[model samples]
Target: MSPLGRPVSLGGGVANRGQVFRLGAAVRRPVTPHSPATHALLRHLSRAGFDGAPRLLSADDRMEMLSWIPGVAARNPLPGWSLSDASLVSVAVLVRRFHDAVRGFDGGPHHWPRPVPPAYSDGLVGHNDLHPGNIVFDGERAVGLIDFDLAGPSGVVWDLATVARCWCPLVADADLPDGFVQGPERRYDRLVMLLDAYGLNRAGRVAVAESLVDNHDWTYRIVTDAASAGHPGFREYWAGVAARTSRARQWAVDHQAELIKAVRR
Candidate 1:
């Protein structure tokens, strides 16, 4: 039977690129070349006893079906609660759990998506994209991560930096979400809180600090390529956002030292 779909919002690059839908107890999304590897990763996570990721039910040439995780995932112009320090801490804990769960898998024979630079690969697959929109939360507590489209081999510190870059955001004050309290002091405090919650060691923290700039550049390259490919959502999103990303990249560059200092504390 052809699955009936009620369009659902699961924000990020996929949502921007194509349609996603709720089909009874599952989510149906257009498949990409990366879908097969994503499916394998999900199966591995399930076998590894991680319940935070959606289960792959089935797939074909067109769309893939994943078991729906019942929770509120944020969208752009994020809600006030999702921006709270409590949310920050919960997301940190969740990502750490995900990393631990994925630690045993050695990538095996699967072709994964978005392989990070050799400087950041550590043999274990990282979610790679942990932006607020991709995380599922039960109230203020983040319970699961939804999108695995960008998952691939990555270092623990690199993955942590990616998550922090989106969650703590590590962006310039001018680019902060509306209603998100602004100030480097608050950013530092939140960064510290996240690293502490994730239980990162001193050396790991320093590495994450150093990688922020590279991560930012890496992310921008992906989106720019997608937009160039004429993905409607990305094309719409890429409009006029270049300056902000430039500022964000520079922010990471300028503050790398201070961030290292705080995380080492």
Candidate 2:
């Protein structure tokens, strides 16, 4: 039940399997047990006045329609617009708003689309992935977020950390976009600014920094494993994109101490 006339593009992530189609202005995923939970969350977010996500339309025979959000998604190395301080701050704010919006929604009874690893901290749902491509930007500003296929109950701080890893990057200099590599200090400052904008407490800050290191390996393993399983999107993405993510991961690991000091300063 995607929008009525928009074209559908295939080949992205493994989780996106099962015939994703676009109708006029919506993208639809086939109906499954997880759909109820996803739909419920989407409905709650929409009702809570968070306009940075899709509007859920009723389910059809095999799909559900979600209102199309217009903007470009910053996939990798990110476009310059996504690297600006303004965009980073906007993203932090938007994610914080979304977390607040869904604070009361229940996921206990429904089956989630993906596994929820252990909670990164006590009160946050594991927002497992908040990478750039999942976020929509409008000229150095985050206008919306797409892809909730992995959202589940976990720590709020952990979720924030996930966002930082992508927006602030926290990756090695060589792995960053050329402009960012030239000014790692400024990029580090942006990460701090993003944290401040999100109003994270000291504990949240620590969790974010630590998660960048801890989750890097786990996240990569998950993607690579999924790719090996013959998931078309992931397989294609791994062949062309994931190999480079390892470099970024190594960059984060190598510079953890420096990044922690910078962010905490």
Candidate 3:
């Protein structure tokens, strides 16, 4: 059991929801920018009328209290619930809302715990990792986003690419699960729809698509490096299916032009 009221499970730092635990009335970890940023981000979301994140309670000795989001996280390849139109739309809308909410807050001058590779020049900060597991779903709809560990000042386009990479998933058709492979064009179409829903301009779309190509290798390297430095969560993740996707990154590079055209169209 964690300082929170329930047993703690490791979150993917992006899409997978944090393990469920009961709320504890104490702060379990030392207060730092990392923890406070979660609080600030959550407060911003709440103030902006988005209710899909954990509610930050005052610090406790054992843990920071946050409201548990009850739903399944849409992990990689996206289980059935997240493949639908409704879930994609909801994800786009919610992330847009979250970005809007955080637009005004200062990230303060604190040093971030992790390396946040710069992408493009959009004013909004990037959530960085928008993998399927970070998104919580109720049936066929996205209800919340979790694990703000990588949130930082970044280009909005970068954030979009991260989301698209996981959701629209620019991998080779063969790399996709059976359900997604059957409707390749539909997936592309959904990418377009999600972009439109986020209210991105043509320039933003182009930047995001390009970034997806340019950043794939760098991002993978960073994840691998982090894992080697004794970050247990990342080490475990990299040791899993992600390590096997070396070819996938090469594929992205090989087909950059085609992917850009698909997303742009």
Candidate 4:
């Protein structure tokens, strides 16, 4: 089918939905500054039997097409399905399987949306954007990850940190939106649960705890860069998101010791 085919607008994604159009059972979006490496990454996922991500169909100068995954994409503050322990464990299992599968794929040198730190990237790619919105859940279980634009070379800890910060969320209450609700032990419980499911050791726990702090800043820096470059979406997201990230960074730093202690369990 042609790229200009009559298409339906895809919902759920907030930031990078520019020129996204879905046709029949496939979805397509402009490649733009995002590298062709994204196609390679998705192809790798397919070959590795990693079914946690969308299957890449094709890519050209105009757009990339992927097998449209059918499921509900979650939003922040989370929903009933995303909040359950069973769903949490299922998501963790998905991430672990992804890491195991990707370790066997060779990414070579390619342009990624974000760079992975040495401490976080050990020659393997991990989905760095495993947040509520990017995950597709069928009922109460995560079926697959939707956004691969930010997936690149990274270690398991980086992936685990992304999962924890979003699912568990270590940010301050002041940063949360009004009417948001979660249990008190949810943070520690979910984070430790993720750690346990990932089979992390003591050193790995320390590294992951530290990454919770770095990830806070790392996530915001990308936005700041986008805003500076005059990205409309980034500018709007920054107006409120920047402050939350700053506070979240501080929160992560303050709770690092506590997280380490808890993650070690």
Winner by lDDT: 1
lDDT of 1 by residue, 197-249 (tens): 99988888888888998888887788899889987777777785788888888
**Across residues 30-120, which tens digit of lDDT does each residue of candidate 4 receive?**
7756657777878888888888888878878877888888888877756655777778888888788888878777766777776877667
Ranking of predictions according to TM-score: 1, 4, 2, 3
Candidate 4 steric clashes:
0
What lDDT tens digits, residue by residue, belong to model 3 across residues 121-146? Answer: 44555577777877888888788877
Each model's lDDT: 0.82, 0.74, 0.68, 0.77
Candidate number that wins on lDDT, 2 or 3: 2
Q: Which ranges of candidate 1 are over 4 A from the true structure?
A: 1-18
At residue 57, candidate 2 shows an lDDT of 75
Query: Is candidate 1 or 3 superior in TM-score?
Result: 1
Q: Tell me each candidate's RMSD, in Å, in order.
A: 2.1, 2.7, 3.6, 2.4
Any idea what lDDT model 4 has? Answer: 0.77
Q: Relative to the unseen true structure, what is the C-alpha lDDT of residue 226 in candidate 3, on a scale of 0 to 100?
A: 71
